[model samples]
Target: MDAAQHISIYSSGNRQPDYSPLQSTLDRLKKRTEENKVTINHTNTVVMHFCTSSQAVAHPQLSVGAHSLQLVQSTRLLGVTVDDRLSWKQHVINIVRTASYKLYMLRRLKSLGTPAKELRDVYTAFTLPTLMYASPAWSSSLTLTQQQQVERTQKRACRIILGPAYDGYDNALTILSLPRLSERHREALGKFGRGLLCHPCHQHFLPPDAPPPRCATRHINKLVPIRAPKTDRYKNSAIPSIVHMINSV
Candidate 1:
């Protein structure tokens, strides 16, 4: 990490509204995540399975919830040190790249194009139990080619975010950054991966932002949906404040 570029440019880039230094860092799709089960020998007796809500592996819980947690936690430690920042930033970039590939792959799958509603419903149903990773999200029925792609992305996410050395598992960037008060906010996950706010929380971890469902503005938006909206009087314990932070971002 170049001190000049990393400290000033990197930190400042984070403050900018549309700045994305990560865009360049995230090149081709990363490698696949490892299987939940690690075979000690050729024998099938010692089998291990990555448990989730459903038998289907592509549903959407662990993929979304877990990933989000890792991202923010790493960001929280940014600019502090070299060894601390490297793996976190690398993992963050890797997860983002893998997640984008997943959305693209899902969208590209002709079978998934039956109807947007059905697709969404199927996703929700297959994903509900696994909502917090109680099931498998993919199927063995996919063509060899597609299976390879899913494996690639999943492996990438798993390796970097859920891998053996993922910075003590304290990611969750955007989610924890939400207000703690609102109870209606749902986890704002990408199509296939998680964000910081993995589960429901009544207040923003940062403190100043209103809860999720409530607007930081004057009124509470029931129609807006999602648990935990920010409150009108919400204030940030951090230096500038969430309002200021949001604007800066």
Candidate 2:
């Protein structure tokens, strides 16, 4: 298949490379724990995770810079501890799992005749944000108890986000966070989501520091327009005005 051509992947072709940066971090953490690395014993890691993954998913092209920046800022509020991040082995594991999710989603979409780009867009919009977590902040390096809590929290979170994987970037989070959305936009969103596959609001707005979208249109939208604002990628010759039958709306 050519690079530009649509690759018919039926949940089997999506393969993300394994990039675990946690194992080495664990080794470092263990050494530090044994040697009393920095005298700081415990702090909240959920805060770091929440900030990092939240920013990453929010950005187009998955900005590691944004994720790391958020991670650093979070460390400031909670506590600065970059001692044991980027563990190699753990990153590899994450790669496999992330790949699995991608593959499954790809196959499902291909079967539905959904374009690869759309599949990528929808999944990136919905799944990535939900996967960003703030629980299970510790692992074997910390203690059995902390590891257990992290595990439980991770599992519970995955459960909450698994089935509704199709609903990319739940605007519901905004509803819960903003009172303005509550009064004016909440009800409209539910109606807006009625078979409304694309997310116009997301296309229009997102947190700053994201990458630029090549084109932001109904048919094809790549990135979320990071570098510039007020950019709209619309088709010049799209035919419209086709009336359709109402299907239980």
Maximum-TM-score candidate? 1
What are the per-residue Cα lDDT tens digits for candidate 2 across 190-209? 23322132344442333233
TM-score of each: 0.21, 0.19
Predicted candidate 2, C-alpha RMSD: 22.4
Task: Give model 2's TM-score versus the native structure.
Answer: 0.19
Candidate 1 error regions (>4 Å):
1-83, 86-88, 104-109, 120-249
TM-score, cand. 1: 0.21
Angstrom error at residue 180, model 2: 36
Instruction: Write one digit per residue (lDDT tens) for candidate 1, span 96-184.
Output: 35454444433443344444344334333332222223101112112345334433443333223222433321232121221211111
User: Largest lDDT belongs to which candidate?
Assistant: 2
Query: Scored by CA lDDT, what does every candidate get?
Result: 0.27, 0.30
How does residue 24 of candidate 1 score in lDDT? 26
lDDT of 1 at 210: 37
Candidate 1's displacement at residue 232, Å, is 26
**By summed lDDT, which 10 consecutive residues of candidate 1 come out lowest?**
180-189
In candidate 1 the C-alpha lDDT for residue 7 amounts to 17
